[model samples]
Target: LYAGVGSLSNIGDQGMEAEEGRAAIWRLDLETEQAGIFASGLRNAVGMAWEPSTGTLWTVVNERDGLGDETPPDYLTSVREGGFYGWPYCYWGQTVDDRVPQDPALVARAITPDYALGGHTASLGLCWMPAGTLPGFPDGMVIGQHGSWNRSTLSGYRVIFVPFAGGKPSGPPRDILSGFLSDDEKTAYGRPVGVAIGADGKSLLVADDVGDIIWRVTAA
Candidate 1:
């Protein structure tokens, strides 16, 4: 099984003391009774799924907050074993974050993610659709962005669809459902957390945490 761990105190801002054993994906082998980190430097990889066509493990990560509204974008990408994704020291492959002290060697080693899900979107849900379901969507991913709080203007608060080609994201994101935030933006009618394809195989099931609702969207 693969489990993702989040860092404490926003990428070691309070100091690396709180970062021990954090910001990584751990793998456990039941047969051997062994456990180890599968990957590192991911701040908050909240959602994960396996792409059926490629059998690749993909993850949707919520990047660090407080970095303004658009500095760093949350991402969806194939998780490489033993890969290092930028968390505190850098973002989006070699973009140096001067807020914290960084090791140049580690920054150079950081790998860029495949697709950007917009900065401060708080993206947390991921689901892959197989062929014959959502014909317009083809074989792709549907993500739920639960919205943002730190930004001056809100972001996310909706579901997005990413088309897949050759086992990777191939086009711009399309909206699935939205309008979770109130008009004034002071209240949230709903917050999407998790998403999955329905058992019927042609509809999408969305888990809304705040409103206590599960939305069902079928292909038209």
Candidate 2:
């Protein structure tokens, strides 16, 4: 079993010391009942999914805030065994985070994410989209971007689709559902968080945390 660990602090760079191991992904052995660190340095690795064609483990990460609306981009990437993702010390492949105490060693090992989901989007939910799951859509990952709180203009209040090829993202993201925010962008109609394929094998399920509703999407 794989479990996610979010960072203790959003922007202060606290509680991420080597010994704390607070920001990481952990694996649990069901038989032996032993748990061990699988990957390290993910600020908030929220949604985990396995690629249908290649079987690679992937996740949508929620990066640290307070870098304005677009300093560092949140991302989606494959999880490597014992890999490091560079949380407090660095971000987005060796771009040093000046706010934190520097760790040259871990910074050298930071693996850049595969796709940038834009900064301050608060992307959280991810689910693998299999081939033929939707008639017009290709195999990909369906992501629920829960939207931003600290940004001035706001972003990511809807669900998006990122196409995948050979178990990796290949194209720009497409909007599966949008218009969650009001015309003036001051009010939120809903905030989508969790996403999954329905039991019927064709529909998609979306969980709106703000509206407290489950939305179903079917081919028209």
Candidate 3:
């Protein structure tokens, strides 16, 4: 079984940077019950999936903050074995975060992510949807952007779709569930979190934290 660790507040501010054994994905051997790190340097890898075409492991990462509202974009990428993603020292593949202590050696080895999901989107939920799973949607990843309180805007309060072809993202992201924020932006009607396929195998299930609702998405 593969599981993720977590992220840090303020992007490792106050000497909380990614250290020797933090912010990593661990692969556990169920037979023997042994677990070890599979990848490191991911700030907050919230959602994970398996691409059906290649069976490769992929994830959505919530990156560091304080570089303005849009410095580093949260990303989606394939997880390579023993890969380092540059959490504290740099972001978006070696851009160099001045806030964190410098580390040229490790930054040089950081892996560039495959796709960007915009800054502070807080994209959390991730589920694999095959072609035609939803009436008009194609094969892709379904993500829930669990809204946060720090941003000055509605950066992430809805669900989105990133189309995939072969084994990678093929097109622009499309809105799956939106209208979460109010017209005045004072109240949020819903905040999406976890995502999954319904038991019937034809519909999508989304968890709305703010409204406490599990939305069932399907063809009308």
Candidate 4:
């Protein structure tokens, strides 16, 4: 049940603390409202999912702006509670522009993400397929890279799959869905924002925000 935020408050500075962005994993045994920080420093996370076999939580994070077209890469990562990802200071486990004073010690202490989905990919919507379902999709983490608008050339207008083994993601991403954009890439018919497994058990459901359509992918 961890959640990510661009900002907790609109004040711009007061709500930027990393601890302010987390939420409880679950509500258990209490009538009172109870929540706590799970992880922090995510600019915006539109996608989250748990690996059904191992119960590991992963998230797709949309990084911050103001960096040039390629400075910071949007990422998909395993979200561990109490983890701190650098925001407004560092990125991708590297110290960024010196304008922001990042403690060298703190930067070294932060956990770098698992995969860099290319700069400005604007990753979103993640899900894991159950084992023994999809024959080739064994690891089962599918992510929607929501493409980019800030870059001169747009990128990431497809859905990708990350295979996992023993609860850990391994190997390069596989393009599960693509070709939603025009041949020239100037226009796109779909901008996939979310992904989920279909009720039929063999299909994958994708939410395309740009076309306002939902696409169903099944074995051919």
lDDT of each structure?
0.88, 0.89, 0.86, 0.73
Model 2's alpha-carbon lDDT is 0.89
Give candidate 1's error at residue 3 in angstroms: 0.5
Give the clash count for model 2: 0
Output the lDDT of residue 147, model 4. 90
Ranking by lDDT: 2, 1, 3, 4
For residues 63-182, what per-residue lDDT tens digits would candidate 1 score against the true structure? 887778887999998999999897778888888888889889889999999999988898999988776776667678889999998888999999998889899998999988998998
User: Where in model 4 is the C-alpha error above 4 Å?
Assistant: 8-32, 103-105
lDDT measured at residue 31 in model 4 versus the true structure, 0 to 100: 59
TM-score of each: 0.95, 0.96, 0.95, 0.85
Model 4, 150-218: lDDT tens digits are: 887788899988888777777788898899788787898888888998998888899999989999988
Per-residue lDDT of model 3, residues 159-187, tens digit only: 99999997999999999889998877899
* TM-score, candidate number 4: 0.85
TM-score of 3: 0.95
How many clashes show up in model 1?
0
Judged by lDDT relative to the true structure, which candidate is superior, 3 or 4? 3
* Model 4: lDDT of residue 187: 91
Q: List the residue pairs that clash in candidate 4.
A: 139-164
